[model samples]
Target: MSDWIDEIKSQLPAGRVLTDLADRSSYSFDASFGQYIPEAVVQAKDKEEVVHVLKVANRWKVPVYTRGQGTCLSGGPLPVHGGIVLDISQWPREIEVKADDLTVVVSPSVLTARIDEEAAKHGLMYPPDPSSAHVATIGGNLAENSGGPRGLKYGVTKDFVLGLEVVTPEGEVIRTGGGTIKNVTGIDMTKLLVGSEGTLGVITEATLKLVPKPPEVQTLMAVFDEVRLAGQAISKTLTSGVLPSKMEFMDKACIRAVESFYPSGLPTDAEAVVLVELDGHPEALEVEAKLVQDVMEDIGARETKIAQSKEEAQEMWHARKQVSPAIAQIKPTKVSEDATVPRSKIPEMIERLRGIKEKHNVEIVVFGHAGDGNLHPNVLCDQRDQEEMKRVEDAVEAIFEAAIELGGTLSGEHGIGTMKAPFMERELGKVGVSMLKRMKDAWDPNGIMNPGKIFPEEGQKLVLRDE
Candidate 1:
């Protein structure tokens, strides 16, 4: 270990190799509750530094994990293998907006919201707005192919990423895609690496495509007597020929949690609430808002309120964002699952989640982007309680199984990190799992880039045997 550290330090700038236990501990885990201390942390400033570290790791046959801002919810950046963590936050910060091409080239460390703010100056917008957009780096967003509320109408991060400057496992720099709008020359390597979760390669820079900013925006909050009613209302709104920029749902458990935290006049007794936003022309927004109101009323909405101004819309959205932190106050730990189904199956999916909670005798606070049918059903519990933790794990497994059973997927935006790798084969059949393994082998033959993550090892024991 000393020899390897000395070699890395000799290759890079002074103080680049971090072996201090305190600093190493900080980079061990992400937002995930699961923790694993990395052996060392390297703060690389440029692609050359990253290449040096990778070459050192390759020589020592040690695992290497790359991390951005460490805000990953899916344990994607967790260094469970006790190796080296390549921190990319020190990478160059550059943003170049080309008005002629309607595109932007940015470094990996650039924040998603910062790009949005920059693009706003040019009357353009990068529409992939994940909930963590405020803190998540563009590199992390591309690695996970992140999607948010706007994904319902605008699409995900993959749709905007036109090119990427990446470093392969062998420390070779490669460029996939370009600034052009159309490219069919060869394999779409850009899309393949977008959601690879750092397994394929490390992203150093990205060229993102931007669209013109919308003119008008309106937000509406509709309270329903039943959770399914709000789901049905979402389908009705989509079928009404009015595309919503954002559509989200929060159950009564989530509503009360947020109301207690904020006291924003949320209905505590309502079974569910659908928060919808439409962005476009002012004349079209007014008509769409009215149509949404009528659709909510037709679907048995108890009360409906439309934001009269931008401030009002922001207030409504802020209330929705408070659900996660507010629920954390009720328990020590929260196991949030990003299970998604077809837009039309949102009602049934929510119903199955309720059934799992009852069967396992656990509390689940449900909320998420209903426009894309991506629901976050969180299981709240104290991790110290042995029995409760077991039940929580069981309930999570049941949720995934139920999701796959209902023609839904195991994850919508959150990648299959360590938490969901055990059931990868269940969702993807034997052949599909084998194909993924082949891809992993083809990308990183030594299995050094985030090992024991997205793919399950052969003959590996299940994490929860009882479940």
Candidate 2:
């Protein structure tokens, strides 16, 4: 470790490499509590420096992990192998908004919201607005193929990524896709690396597609007597041809949690709530808003309120954004799962999640992008309670199984990092899992780039064993 650290230090600037335990501990984990201290952390300033670090690590047979702001909830950035974490948040950010081309060229470390702000200057916008946009890097967003409230209408990060500059596992740089709108050039490597979660390559720069900013926007909140009614309302809204930019849901438990955090006049007695946002021309938005309201009322919504101003709309969104933190306040630890199903099956999936909570005797707060059928059922528990933690794990597995059975996926935006890699086989059949492993081997022949993640192991271990 000392020899490798010295070699890396000699290659880069004097202070770019860090081995201090305090700094190392800071890079150990992401937003999730999972932690694995790396032997060293290097904050790379340029693509050349990243190549230097990767080449040295490859030569020394040391594991290398790339990280952004460390805000990953799926543990994608966790340095589980404890070798080197190539912190990319320090990389230079440059956003070039080419209005004529309807695209933007941005550095990997650029914040998602900053791109939107910059695009807005040119009357344009990038629509994959993840909840963590304020802090998450564009590179991390592409790595996970992140989606958020707007995904129901504008789609996810993958839809907007037109091109990328990536560094392969062998420290070779390559460009995939470009500023052009359409490309049928080759194997579509850009899309493949977009959601590979750094196991395939490190994204240094990206070209993102942009759309015209909507002239008008409106938000509406509908309260339901039961959660199923809210789900039905969501189905009705989509079926009615009103493509809301944001369609979110929160159950009673989640609403109460948010109320406790910010008593913003949320209906405490309601069993469920749906927050919807429409963006387009004012005349069209008005028509769509009425259609949504009528559908919600027809679906048995107890009450509905439409935001009259942008400030009120922001306030409504603030309540939804407070969910994770609010649930965290209920317990020291939280296990958040992003299981998505068919839009029509959301109610049934929610019911199954309720059953899991009752069976395990644990509190589960549910909320997420209802229109897209992505639900985040967060199980709050104390990690110190061994027995309870075991039950939580079992409950999570049951939830994943239920989602799969309902034609859903184990994850919506969060990649299959170490946390979900064990269940990759359960989601993807044996042949499917093997195919993924073969692809990983082909890309990373030396098995050095973020190993033990996104692929099932050979011995068929159901869980990852610390090496």
Candidate 3:
């Protein structure tokens, strides 16, 4: 063991630092591709322990990859470099809701859904509810700036974050933003670190903004015989003055997979289905629901069904939540990519996805937050087949190109970890990426904070198959 490892163990509790291969191997990979073993794993429970671990790692010029629940779809917590895996998931969970101020102070280890559950006690709501909120930690959500179906109307995780208590890469403690809703004291460092994928600093604590719970919510499911018409209906409804709190889309492949996996009463025969949720006053929702129904029908929807009761509405959303696990059962390997385009270009983007699927001969199931144009086009294949995996890689690259070509982005909710790093320059341009690199270099001078992420290596390309 190195002096740094000894120092970390000495500083933290007796059982906090794990140098055994079994423990290290457990922290190797996350939800995304690739696996890398770290030399040591440190479970820091509090801010002081985090500071100590970072100080020792920084002094030793060792890479420190901070991780939460390891539920990141974009590979945010994968420790690609062999150094220290700073595991924060073991930290004690803390959630303090200030009802009067409409804010919540929480520890990094708190489950993302717990914040909203606590807020609900005070008739308040935390809007950024990611699908993995029940399993994911707030630290990981902040690191990746996660999004959910509600993101179409409420925005992503970054929008709800009012402040953060961060531990710098060099082990210095600094507070950015505050508990207040509006703070223009200086630079917006909170926004910078929120979506940075943990390259700049490690978040110890955070203050999140909360909103009042909606009085009523109505659910609507629109069936389409054609995929293009489904895309067109999404754009038309958003423009028709009825903004839904949640607008999700599912292709026939996803619908069938969900039905087969969990038996959600979804129409497998339809080409596509658009699920809509409108929230607000009951009277307004009643008016908005009708408007949305009319818009869907006018835009070529074959049928529109409105949930008659809250239980029915819950079932609809629950079925949508099951899309990920449902589709996973279709194939042994699922390559989930979130390539987002503009609302007006959604129809075209779907067309491009179809073309890419046919051209590459890959099985792709489309489903995601359609109102925001963040589509999750998943390619299902057997990774053991090298030839098919190669085709999947090419198909993934084509998806990225199509998004950028249509004035869209490489990722909307998922952060650009190693999986999408190679295509960063394509979306941000050379100069734009260079500016980001300069900022990253300044914040992490030793490059010890989560290296080999966001920025690609010289010849790195999208490789899913084992080399």
Candidate 4:
């Protein structure tokens, strides 16, 4: 073992440091592609423990990868050049809600869903609802700037974060932002670190902003015969002055997959389904619901179903939630990409995705928070087949190109971990990426924090298959 590992063990409590191969192997892979076994895994339970691990790793110039629940779909926490995996998921969960101030201070280990659940008791709500809220930790969500259906109206994790207590790469503790809503005291370091994919620092605690729970929420499902029509309906409804709390899109492939997996009453015959949720005063939602319905019908929706009750609405959403798991049943491996475009270009983006699918001859399933133009286009394939995996990699690259061509980003919510590193320059260009690297260098001078991420290494390419 290295001297840094010994030093970390000396500082942290016994049994918190794992050097066994079995224990190390457990942290090798996350929900995303690639696997790398770290030399050691350190379970940090508090700020002091995180500080010690980072200090040792930084002193030795060893890479330190911060991780939460390992539910990252974009390889955010994977230890590519691993020395120590700082596992904060084991940290004691804390969710302290200050209802009067509409803010919640929480430990990084707290599950993202629990924050909202705690806030609900105070008649408040945490708006950033990532799909993995129940399984993923708040630290991971904050690191990746995760987004979900609610992101259309409420924004992503970064927007809700009012303050953060993060440990710098060299083990320096710093607090950015504060409990109040407005804080322009200095540089917006909170925003910079939130979506940094753990390249800059490790977050220990966070203060999240909450909002009063909506009085009423109405759900509507719009079924379209043509995929493009569904996209048009989403764009039209957003412009029609009825902004929904949640607007999700799922294509025929996703619908059929859900029905096959969970037997939801989704119309498998429809080419696409646009699920909309409007929340506000009951009276306003009633009018907004009608207006949205008219827009959907006018835009060529064959059938528009308004959720009659909360149960009905839950059922509709339950089906939408099943899209991911259901689609996974189609193939052994799923390459999920959140390639987002502008709202006006949604229809065209859908058309382009279709073209890419047909051109590449791959099974592509599309679904996501479409109201924000963030579409999750998944490519299903068997990784065992190298020939097919190569094609899948090519198809994924083409998908990134298509999104950038349409004035969109390579990633909407998922941060640029190893999966999207190679394409950073494609979207940001050389100069933009260089500026980001300069900022990163200024933050972590030794480059021991989450190495081999965000900024691409020389000659790096997206390789999903083994050598």
Please estimate how well model 2 matches the true structure, expressed as its whole-model Cα lDDT. Answer: 0.88
- Residue 264, candidate 3: C-alpha displacement in angstroms: 3.1
TM-score of candidate 3 versus the correct structure, residues matched by position: 0.98
Per-model lDDT: 0.89, 0.88, 0.92, 0.92
Local error of candidate 4 at 344, Å? 0.9
lDDT of 1 by residue, 1-467 (tens): 57888888898876878888999988977876577898889988898888888777777877888999998878899997988999998887789999779999999999898898999999999999998999989999999999999999999999999999998887778999999999986999999999999988889999999999998899999999988788889999999999999999999999999999987788999999999999999998999899999999998999999999889899999999999889999998888889888888888988888899999999998999999989999999987787888888889989999889888888899888787888888889989989988987897777788887888766643342223
Q: Of the candidates shown, which would achieve the greatest lDDT relative to the real structure?
A: 3
Kindly list the per-residue Cα lDDT of model 3 for residues 304-399, writing each as its tens digit: 999999999899888888988898888989998999999888888988999999999999989988999999999999989999999999999999
List candidate 2 segments past 4 Å from native. Answer: 458-467
lDDT of 2 at 111: 92
List of clashing residue pairs for candidate 2:
none
Better of 1 and 4 by lDDT: 4
How many residue pairs clash (N, CA or C atoms closer than 3 angstroms) in each of the candidate models, in the order given? Answer: 0, 0, 0, 0
Off by over 4 Å in 3: none
User: What would the TM-scores of all predictions be?
Assistant: 0.97, 0.96, 0.98, 0.98
Ranking by lDDT: 3, 4, 1, 2
Candidate 1's C-alpha runs over 4 A off are: 458-467
lDDT of 1: 0.89
lDDT of 2 by residue, 1-467 (tens): 47988988987887879888998998988876567999999999888888888778888878888999988877788887789999999888889999999899998899999999999999999999888999999989999999998999999999998899988888899999998889999899988888898898788899999999999899999999988899889998998977899999999998899999988789999999999999999999888888899999999999998898889999998999888888889998888889999999999999999999999988898999999999999989988887788788788888899999999999998878877877898889989988978888898888778876787555633231222
**Model 4: per-residue Cα lDDT over 226-314, one tens digit each:** 98888888888888877899889998899999999999799889999999999999999999999999999998999998989999999
RMSD of 4: 1.0
Lowest-scoring 10 consecutive residues by lDDT in candidate 1?
Answer: 458-467
